[model samples]
Structures are given as C-alpha cells and as structure tokens.
Target: MNTNDATRATAETMPDLFALASSMEDDMHKVSDLAFLINDYLTRGDRITLEMQQALCWPASELVEVGRKLRAHSVALYAASKRPATLLNEETRP
Candidate 1:
C-alpha cells in the first residue's frame, strides 16, 4: 500500500494501540507498587532475618530491571504512535 493507505490503516488501529499502551501503563504501575513494597520490606527496621533480606535482594534487582524494560517499551510505543509512517516502514523492511 501507499503511504496514505498505510497511514490510514495505522489510524484505524489507533484505538487498539491506545488500549495496549494503557494496559502497559497499568502494568508499569503495578510493577512500581511491587518494587516499593520490596524496598519497604528490605529497609524496614530489623524485623526480618539476614537470610530473608539476602533472598529478597535478587528479586528486588530483577523488579528494577523489569521496570526499566517496561518504561523503555512504553516510550517506544509513544514514539511509534507519534510517527505511524516511520513505524510502518520499519515493520515492512526486509
């Protein structure tokens, strides 16, 4: 299809795109909440044992990584929405 057709098609899918973005944002919020909880648990006055703290360290780090990835994806999605022609061209490239 030509550029106009491609752009029109992208426009038609805008609602779905927005929904997906919204879902991603919700997921990011949930991830943030979990990270906050983990941080609170790890930092709260010495109620937990050292072993428990050590066990949480890895998961906490993983959550941070996940949050970063989610944020990056969200930004990418926003960028794509702002330039549908560019996104369409990139997708169809061999």
Candidate 2:
C-alpha cells in the first residue's frame, strides 16, 4: 500500500496505539512534578486567572488513562532490559 493508505489503515485499526506504546515517562513525570511546583505558586497567592485555570484543566479520566499506559510501558521496558537475551529463545538456549 501507499504511505497514506498504510497510515490510514494503521490508525483505523489501532487508533492511538502508537501514542500508548511510546515512552512518555519523562514528560509525564515532568507534568506530575510541575503540578507540585504549581501548588507552591498557589500557596504564595499567585493569581491564576479563570481562563488560565480553564485552559489547564484536564479530565481525571484522561490523566488516569495516560498514566496507566505509561506505567505499563515502563514495566515492559524494564523487563526487556533486565531479562537475559538467552531466555527469549527457548530452543536455542535449552
């Protein structure tokens, strides 16, 4: 298939699979950390306008979904990194 057709097919089949599969751990971690930093700002009575707050608002469900995906990706990556390559091939190893 052509590039456009291939892209369309993949998107149609898996939707956001690429996003869910890619590592966003660092970015997500920064977001989580920034939340704490922002709390400090709020504690200092730094005004966050209603429009700004509205712009920053994210749904809990969406955050939960991304967090879950990121966690699963991290676990898979850790296992792949720590496990012996020999164990991946049963016939070759044993």
Identify the candidate with maximal TM-score.
1
Tens-digit per-residue lDDT, 45-64, candidate 1 = 32443444365454544545
Considering every candidate listed, which one attains the maximal lDDT? 1
How big is the positional error of residue 23 in model 1, measured in Å on the Cα after superposition?
12
> How would you encode candidate 2's per-residue C-alpha lDDT over 9-40 as one tens digit per residue?
54543423334345565546635644644444
TM-score against truth, every candidate:
0.42, 0.37
> After TM-score superposition, what is the CA distance of residue 29 in candidate 1 from its true location, in Å?
12
Supply candidate 2's per-residue lDDT for 24: 67
Name the runs in model 2 displaced over 4 angstroms: 1-55, 86-94
Where is model 2 poorest over a 10-residue stretch in terms of lDDT? 85-94
